[model samples]
Target: MAMSPEQPSAPRRSRIALWLVLLLLLALGGYAGWHQWRAREQAVVNSTQQQVDALSERLNAMRTEQRAQARRLQQADSLNRVLRDELDGITQRAALLETSVERLADPDRHGAQALRLDETEMLLTIGSQRLQIAGDLDGARRAYALAAGVLDGIDDPAYLSLRQTLLQERTALDALGADPRVRAIAQLDAYTQTVTAPAGREERARDERAPWWQRAFGNLLQVQPTDRAVAVQAADRAAALAGLQLEISLARAAAERRDTAGYRDALRRADTWLQRLAPDSAARTQQRAQLQALAALPLSLSVPTLGSTLQQLRQLRAR
Candidate 1:
């Protein structure tokens, strides 16, 4: 009834074969799991790289925007400086004009002359500034026209004035360049050369004689038409005095009549005179005092009484 040795060996061999098959199946399963894990890790690495690239792109864009903003700030600062300088220049010119106006109120001849000169200078400055502004504005307009594909109207008054001013400036420059004195000064060396030449003495002697017309006129034009000048000067002086006197008289009459409009007009005229007087003249001081006194006078005075008072004052001043 005991089992044979061969039968025991056969059972052991079958158990070994079964163990080998199980080992092979376990090895295949481990290899598949390792492959799947490696694939998942690679996918995660790719996703991380994509995120990093996106972040880099965003950072570059932000840097570009910052640079643009910085440039804009610089341009704005430059423009602000230009505007400030221009405004300062304008303010200085305006202050000078106001000072000149204050000078005009004086009644003295010196003050009047100074005021006239100041006014003339101011007018010239205004014309020059207008010309400059017109040129700059025209340039701006041209640029706009180019951009917008349209031309501005040439018939505009400002445009016409600008053109006229440009023409005048050019003509003035040409005239200055062609002046005899300027030409002579510029050609001094040439003149010297000619004068030193052996054949120059006779020509120089002939040039010394006065022209026939000049000899005949006997310096008539050189006398400056003194009679006419004197008459015109007298007329101008009378007109200026009369204008101030008339305003004062009007103010007095308005006071008598209690007419506010007339009083206001007289005050305005006085103010205008003050503005037209020279700053350093004695006449301006007198005018200022007169204006103050007139302003202080009662607006509702009795006509007869005011007339009597004015007449008495005039008589006293004359005496």
Candidate 2:
């Protein structure tokens, strides 16, 4: 009935314990390997993120450097332009100085007689052109008188006839009157201010106030009166306005050139344009007086010519 020593049972329990310890060791090794793998993956991800951040910083620095370089290039271009302009100015000044030195070195430019003659001739030319173009009679007279005085100082018997011719031209310029085109423009401006209603427009406005039935009857029978004053068509009036303005400007130009006939033609064209645009004789009643006054002026006048005198002076100078 008493228990003896059981070695097999004890050995079986020891073997089972050994198996349990081996299983525990294997599970611990698996967990340690998984943790190390996860750590390596996280480290790789962090390294990649750091490399991307470094690349972005390098890109930003490159952009900033490029922008600064562009600014420097623009500034250099501006500075070069300024320097070029200054250099050009210096070159011009140098050229002008060289011209002055060259003139001083020439011996032929020292004579007072030649200088006076050239100056006088230039004055005569300016005067003749002024008289012919601008009708500046007074300015022409003064210039001719000055030229005659210069000729007198020359004390040359060869220019006697030239002096007499200049005197004659001076007398002719003294007789010239003011430009007549100025008065014409004044008259036109006055006429323009004299706009008036056409004859039948007022009567039509009164007739419009009648009863509706009466107006219908009048309109149907064509017995009651309405305005015969035709309104200016918008398109025609616009064209006429342009034409009138052009003609007026031409008239002014002709007057400035002392072309009496041309000025008259331009004025007449403007008048015709106005008539065509308005087409109401009664409306022109207000401007009739101004129109008559404008028409009364002579179309042409006896303007003195100095071509012969100028030619004779040039011939004398050549002699």
Candidate 3:
């Protein structure tokens, strides 16, 4: 029962060793928990940063698109405003033109005004008719000239707008007639008058000139009595028909040559001469048929658009 002191001390030592081992395990566990907590915190912070970066990029793109859209909207708005302003100006001008036309048409019109209206109206009618029926540029220009002449006398500031509109319309019509095809027929007609007669003409002229010297100087230089009343013997009906037929043939040739005026003139002369030929002649039927063929030929230029300025002026005048 009496234990030694050394045995009691041994128990004490063993107790100390167990206590030290438990402390070491607790310290190691604490260190491991701290490290895991720090790693978790770092992971959370990195994820938040990535989300913020993605959101920032999206916001920047949205901002850029919005700015571009704003610019486009501003440009479109500016364009619309400009167009509206132009439309407003046009409307105001149209109203002014209408009012002026009404005043011009009123009773107690001035002498000069009446003259101007009459001449302008007549010229407009002439120009329209020429363009519509024959597509005659020269005729249209003559009408336009007459209208310009009438406008030339107007000194009143009140008439300036009307005169300007007329000038504009004339310019529009001039542009329409600028094409060469539109003028070919009239140009050909002018050429027809200058064209020399065909081959036999030189021989006939020489034959006539052979007798000219005899008529100029009588025998022994005596003055010959002129037979002023030498009646033209009735032209042989058959020969007349044949000559008209020849004219039609020449007209066809001219048509082939693209000589519109020469063809028309020749055909017209032939038609007139055909009428003079005896109706009973056998060639009359054939000649009449030829005249019909010539009449069927198309010589008109392309129909041009009547200008809007003149049309508007007319509508304003009516109002």
Best by lDDT: 2
**lDDT (tens digit, per residue) of candidate 2 on 130-161:** 76666566677778888877877876676677
Candidate 3, 207-254: lDDT as tens digits? 467566754553336342374221112334445556766776676567
Q: How close is candidate 2 to the true structure, as a TM-score?
A: 0.47
Clashing pairs in 3: none
Which parts of model 2 are misplaced by more than 4 Å?
1-20, 111-134, 147-319
Off by over 4 Å in 3: 1-8, 110-319
lDDT of 2: 0.69
User: All candidates' TM-scores?
Assistant: 0.34, 0.47, 0.34
Candidate 2 local lDDT, residue 150? 82
Per-candidate Cα lDDT values, in order, are 0.49, 0.69, 0.64
